[model samples]
Target: MSEVGMNKRVMLVEDDLDLAVLIQDFLERYEFTVSVVSDGQDAVTRIIAEQPDLVILDIMLPGLSGMEVCRQVRQQYEGFILMQTALDDDIDQMLGLELGADDYVIKQVQPRLLLSRIRALLRRAAPLQFASSEQQSFDYQFGALKIDLTRRMVLLYGQPVELTTAEFELLCLLAKHCGEVVTREDIIQQLRGLEYDGLDRSIDRRISRLRKALQDDAKEQDQVIKTVRGKGYQLCIR
Candidate 1:
């Protein structure tokens, strides 16, 4: 059992009884407390009530569908959500992220790979522990937008802007390098711990979501975040 998995609660929302049991057993071996909810509605209720550290949510569910469950539970629960889909469908993946899923894994993937994804998401959710706090700035402001890294909060024009964990992290990365183009390769490596395959659209989707939360128009040249054609993205400084 890995010490890092100790005390971590994971809720697996998979309708397949056999698959759920297998995943639960594998995760348990790593010292993670795992709970299984087969119904989407039940998962939402339990997720809100229990607020587990992470949720392994299946896209297809009996009661409410995983997408619906995600939309509903996100109103209250702020924990990490890792969606699962049987097929490698772009629409499903994009919709999952738009609905607040932190990341996703295909059903055919190995259990160990799924475990790796879970660990990556958990690491991102955890607060950064730096040896020297003085070297880092926990707060950043760009015009009407304000980001408080310490509090994991974002405000726009003095009003709180609701953003998922992934969106917030992307925004922070862009803010940290405001006015500088952050390549897709850099973002994938830093945020997802995966090399950019030049085909993954996850980063673009998150950027769109973040822009919407910030009320920034990507079409405008003076937008808060500008797409550097063929390069990546740049957070404009006000």
Candidate 2:
């Protein structure tokens, strides 16, 4: 069944016709206005022109490749990016995150789960849209790290820091519980709507990447987000 009054826009970049059709059909049913581009070059051009709310990108695309597309678009587009690809290798995943992808979903994902991820990203993007005046200004300043929730922007030492979607959400979650330990279980549930089985290391990888972006030297003194050995991660800014 299609959702009512959900006018969120999405751009889907895939070379596979069958898969693209399947995704478009399913998302349209849920009230998303999706635009399709089969090649990376076209994806970049349209993205710059339209500025969709979210972009679903394929890693392997004709012409420029998905990685190239993401790199180019990141320079101008500030919308959410979800990388959906058939290549599920660790290197691919790491590259996607390093290139500023918001989320990475391997191909053959259940439509329901994919839809949930889409909804989650959109929700994070507009967290305080419906909140009261007091709640509307959602900004967190911790030492050199200043987070402007309304603009979905983060700054480190007064310089802008570009964070992927997942990284930003992790920061937000920690800030909401500032000075409290946010376990891995809670992080997985909040970001991916998945239960942490104590085996997945994706969250840890994200933390490492985020630390580098925030200039937190893990080898020296852990201050930004400190690890509690076995418990979880805490955002400590002093």
Candidate 3:
């Protein structure tokens, strides 16, 4: 029964009744308000209407696929979406991220590990608690791009850019170290509090999504976020 989970609403979209009940019970023990919806269409409708703090969405479901539900709900809802996939396939994870999923976990993942991931996502979604006055006052501007650290908002050419929580965090990380290469290990450690396994493509996927939101060409020579060969990424301060 963790106090951190208190008052937080989590909607579980797993279709397996037994599994759903198990997850719901486990999360409830942690003091989170849990809701279960087995159908994708129903999940979308309820999620839009209820607007839970976070959605634990499964890829497979009756009626509508999880991908469709994510796509449709994302158009209207801005809540954190944590996708679940039974397969450990990269395509599923990448596609889900591209479709605005904030994060994903495999169905076979341990319950405690799932809880930890959920906590991590929720922490990121929460308003920043700055540790220093400089951090509290930090904001960045590079040409047409502008990022307000305090407001957690990004503007491109005076237009608001819609970004997932993960994308915004990654962009802020890069912006904070503008013109400096922020390594993969540094990014993973700072953002996830985990070691970079060297195989995890989630960061790359997020960078791709961020680049798209920033209207930066990833393949071009003069990219806003330039990939430094074996090094990580650098935010070119134009």
Candidate 4:
């Protein structure tokens, strides 16, 4: 559970009444103020209006469906959206992610795991606080790689980079610790609240995707994200 007194708001858009109640009760107990919207249309409206910190949206919902709801809410809402999906619905899960969902969890999720995921997403959405006043500005730039933290936009070599939520978060994390070898353990812990189990390749896959997006050659010696052999990854900027 997060520290007391900070009641981060969360909205749960699930059509199943029992599941909604269960999730709501659990989240509230963890110090999050949770609101339940059973219908997808209602969720869209309430989300746009209320602008909660995080949204736990079930993919199968009344009226709009989770995919449609995510698409609509993403247009205006800048906060995180954690999609709830069935294990077999990989296509819908991918679609939701492409639609700007921060992450997706299986529908039959344990409350503790859900809470961990929520905390991770919130951490990613949190601002990158730097000690220097000049570094606190909204825009961060290194050579041709530039990021507008407020706008959540990234540009590489004068071209706009279209990145998914996870990809963007990884890029931001790397940029935040530029020139330092951020260990894989730290990366996974900060990004997902899970310890590196030595077999999880998701972060490595994301780094590959980010390298492609940034046009960085992993084969080259000089690039944005450099693999430090056994150490970890480092973001180097001139």
Using lDDT as the measure, which candidate wins?
1
> What TM-score fits each model?
0.62, 0.65, 0.64, 0.62
Model 4: which residue pairs collide?
none
Clashing pairs in 3: none
Sorting all predicted structures by lDDT, with the top scorer first, yields 1, 3, 2, 4
Model-by-model lDDT, in order?
0.84, 0.82, 0.82, 0.81
Pairs that collide in candidate 2 are none
Relative to the unseen true structure, what is the C-alpha lDDT of residue 114 in candidate 2, on a scale of 0 to 100?
86
Regions of candidate 2 where Cα sits further than 4 Å from its true position: 1-5, 127-204, 212-224, 228-238
Worst window of 10 by summed lDDT in candidate 3: 129-138
**Residue by residue across 72-188, what tens digits does model 1's lDDT show?**
998799889999988977689889887888787888579988887777667655544434433545489888777877556676766667665668789999999998999999999
lDDT of 4 by residue, 55-141 (tens): 999988889999999999898998889998877354665688778887888898898888867776676454444334344344678
Native RMSD of candidate 4 (Å): 7.0
Per-residue lDDT for 43 in model 2?
A: 91
> By TM-score, who's the top model here?
2
- lDDT tens digits, residue span 1-238, model 2: 3332268999999899898999999999988998889998989999999999999999989998898999998989988889986855757878877787878788888998788778767765543433243343438988767788756667665556766666788899999898999999999999889999989888898899888888887765757889988989989976
Q: Report the lDDT of model 1 for residue 173.
A: 96
